[model samples]
Target: MTAPLLEPPGGRPLRIGSRTSLLATVQARHVAELIHEYAPGVATEIVPIRVSADVWDGDLSRIGGKGAFSKEIDRALVAGEIDVAVHCMKDVPGDVPLAEGTAFGAYLERGDVHDVVVTRDGTPLADLPPGSVVGTGSVRRRAQLGMYRPDLRTERIRGNVDSRLARLNEDGSGYAALILARVGLDRIGETAQPQEVLPLEFHQADEGVVSMVPAVGAGVIGVQARQRDLAVMSLLGGLNHDQTARHILAERSMLHELRGHCNSPIAGYATTTADGAMSLHGMVFNRDGSELVRFHCSGSPDDPAALGSEVAAELLRLGARRLIDATGG
Candidate 1:
């Protein structure tokens, strides 16, 4: 027999896992708020965990850190220590690497995913003076910028969103800009610093929707207490942005096929028409972002993932594979 959805478990509150970071906590609270608004009677408990990626002195460039922020919470999920864990979708690894029996329950509506340029002077990228060094931790940003201005240099940066912004806001004489996540900026209310946010449709890789990319089955927060956790699922799934899911599915599949790594200079986006026809766009670039190959495929949302994979194969045939091998990403 299954327990009631909102039965006054008056005994104990349901626990949800969250990271110890301020931003992670904020995301958890956002998720919790949604639950409280929709699912009555069930209380949420926050389980904070530490992750290695929170290094105080480690160089993000040297660590090759992928999923550094998510591994610990994922472990807690797999171990049955927490009911659900909230996460940033892009931070999720290409493959859900968690133990069986544990899965992501559903996705929250996504946020923007474009890389933004935050210049201290609020100047556009094109206006940056010569020899301007751009601060960014992402190779994608580095490559994209390189494509536009090979004269610009990429400086390795590390830390939470706040910390990165601090570095950008701080003087790096000759430093013209920093690449940041549009979602992060909006979440923290700091979108004013950058002169412009790239529109994914206009800029090869710009700001756009987010998607829940949980470890396998964890696409949504795995509100698992028992097999019939339907009420919890319904409340959250009701928030699923269908277009976001289609975009992410196609993007993830493309990443999987192209072997897109954390450091790979890869970009993908999906958009939909009023009639619901889905158009998927993806690209693979060399480390310098100088050599880029783009491909697009359209289909019904029914098989966006297949469409993504098909385009990826076409990209590979056109020489994207050689660039990946050369970059070792």
Candidate 2:
């Protein structure tokens, strides 16, 4: 039986906060759609807010790392200007806790966790010429690229997905390729055909040679609201996917324990099995990817946090701390 829809006070539409980017807007609208599906009579309004990270063209670490992406929207949410804030889980910093008054209301089902390499001439990553330059802003991606093809070079590229693609397509951009999250492309409807889509498996012959470990919370959308707003929390709870939440909880547990930041060359992913077990895979790398520390652990899905912590502890014991500290994380 369907419960009565809980409309906001005074019958006002819930204002959904989002970064003023096309991709962010799309994600915000998707959340609105989910709300409508969950409660046919409830209303939602997406409010676009420009964040510091959008205007800052320099290194993100200089301006509080990836947290810059959500600070403004979080402020608006806390100030009661917005009812909910939509965020890409990967953009949410793990080194610190969420804002004092904010809490994640729900996490949508996960998307494609693998990354894709886009080349101008449709050349595969392995086929790229030596000394070719790949473009990315993530230290993790840069390190992994170095591990996969030491002969290649990487240049930092930052902007919205479309702008990055534009830069890659420009003449003399010097970007032989750009590595992007597959889910980001899918969200903005930009991924028609990519040169090479990397897989999540580790050295699986049929998938690909390079095993690209995804960032914690990659390919997930998190909806956050005031921790004290019981009504809003109740409305969003219906949208949460239990399996995805478990996986994310495990991954985030490891990230939080490791204190990974934007500049940190850290990657972790979590998966669940049909038998109610979960496993977390974690890795830390040096800036140039010349060295790596990897660990994996499995446990009951009911205690995902413990499994993630176990993996993180093992990785740290294997000297991941040295690599992370070297990057100033």
Candidate 3:
């Protein structure tokens, strides 16, 4: 038998907090829909909040690192301005602890985890002219690109997907291509063609085939609420996707163990099998992709964190710390 749905305090509509960006609002609405499905009669409201990362035109590291994206929303959550907060797991910094008094109540099912390339004319990455410039904000992506195409140069590009696409379309924009997460583009209704999807392995002229590892928590959405709020937690718990949650746990565990920061060129992906086993792949790279260390391992799904830590330990032993510290991450 299903349990009775707990009503919000005072019978008010449950308010969901999200960033002001169109993508953020869309994601928040998705969460609201999930809530509605879980409790047919429950009422929900979306609250758009502006975050520091959105307003700051300068480098994100200058403000408060990656937390700039979530701090304000977290503050609202802690202050009772909203009942729940939605976040893209990839944007959540792995090195730092989450906001005090708050914890993630659920992680939505994972989405397409592959990164895709968007070019002006749908050109394959390898066919691009030598010295052509690619734009991306991720150190991990930049480093991987360096490893893949030493002749190609990378410029830092920041903004939401639309703005980035606009930059790519601008007359003077030097970007020959922009690499983005496939899921983000799909969510925003900008699906990439099959040829544009970057393969997991690419042929590097001299180095043979190289693999592009995805960032930790790349394709997951996390729902957060105050830890002590039983009603909210109970409500949000129903939305958790067990397999996705396990993968996030393993990936995040590896990230936490590595002490990776926004500047850290770290990538990790975790997967679970139907047999209750899990595998994690972790990699760390230098700023320019001149150095890299990677490790992979399998373990019991019951202890995802342990598996993540094991991979992290292996990476550290292989001199991942030196590469991470060199970038001052």
Candidate 4:
């Protein structure tokens, strides 16, 4: 028989696994708050787990790529160290499967789903001069920047959001602009910086200058727990935002169908209409943005995964896989 959802448990507070970074801690704390709100008196603790991506101090692609960030937390979950784990959904890989007995149980409400361009002096993308160095580690961003302004050179950047912004805010011969996630900025409360935050739809140099289809599950926080953990699952299920989960699942399914890595230069976004239909926009680009493929599909929100897979299939039929492979993502 299943245990009651709110049967006063033992003295141990439910432990939550999360990364140690400031932004990660903030997200984890938010989840903890939600759990407390949903089940008053259900104690919870935050457990910080170190990850390979945080310690590799080198190229992630050459190491383990996106999985490096969440693998440790997942391990904690599998090892019985943490009752639940919070994740920046984008860090969860599409190609790498999850550990046995573990799965995402809920998705917190979504946040801003667009990447913002931050410039040293709030200069619009078009105003930037040729040969300007833009710092970013994302292949998609690099390719999109090339597509917009081929003359601007790109330098690989790796660090937490704050560190990246600090480097750009400092006076140096470093990047003139940095491409960062707007959601992250808001979470960290660093939106008041002197840099300009350009809208995803902002046009300057050319049509679709900075395409922002968004990474799959970009602004969502996922709560993960052992599938059979009835108590944890029940508690988190109360916090799940059905609409956000549907959108993320659709995006994730589209990514999975392409056999693309989570860190691949692929971008996809899904939105639900008032009438309960889901529409997905997906894009695939070669390493240099020399080639581009874009597609869209709509379906009932009740079957987001199917809609996502269908869109991905259409994209692949049009040679999306070829473009994805060329990037080595």
> lDDT of each model, Cα atoms only?
0.65, 0.88, 0.86, 0.82
User: lDDT value for candidate 2?
Assistant: 0.88
Lowest lDDT block of 10, candidate 1: 210-219
Clashes of 3: 0
Residue 125: error of model 4 in Å? 1.4
On TM-score, the stronger of 1 and 4 is 4
* Model 3, span 130-195: residue lDDT tens: 999988888899898888788899888887887888899899888899888888888888764433
Clashing pairs in 3: none
Regions of model 1 farther than 4 Å from truth: 1-10, 56-64, 95-98, 171-174, 202-235
Q: For candidate 4, write residues 48-125 as lDDT tens digits.
A: 998888766566777778988988888899999988999999888888888899888899999987788887678877
Clashing pairs in 4: none
Please identify model 2 stretches exceeding 4 Å from their true place: 1-5, 204-208
TM-score of each: 0.84, 0.96, 0.95, 0.94
Native-to-model Cα distance after best TM-score fit, residue 300 in candidate 2, in Å: 0.3
Clashes of 2: 0
**What are the per-residue Cα lDDT tens digits for candidate 2 across 89-114?**
99999987788888998999999998
- Measured by C-alpha RMSD in angstroms, how accurate is candidate 4? 2.6
lDDT tens per residue, model 1, 1-329: 23246542445666778878667777788777767766656688888888767774454334444667676777787666776777766666563343455555556655655556788767877777778887876666677777667777788776787877776666544456777776666776766675466555434333322111111111222232222455545545654566667667777787778876666667667768778888777777788876878777888888988888888898898888887778763
Return the number of clashes found in candidate 1. 12
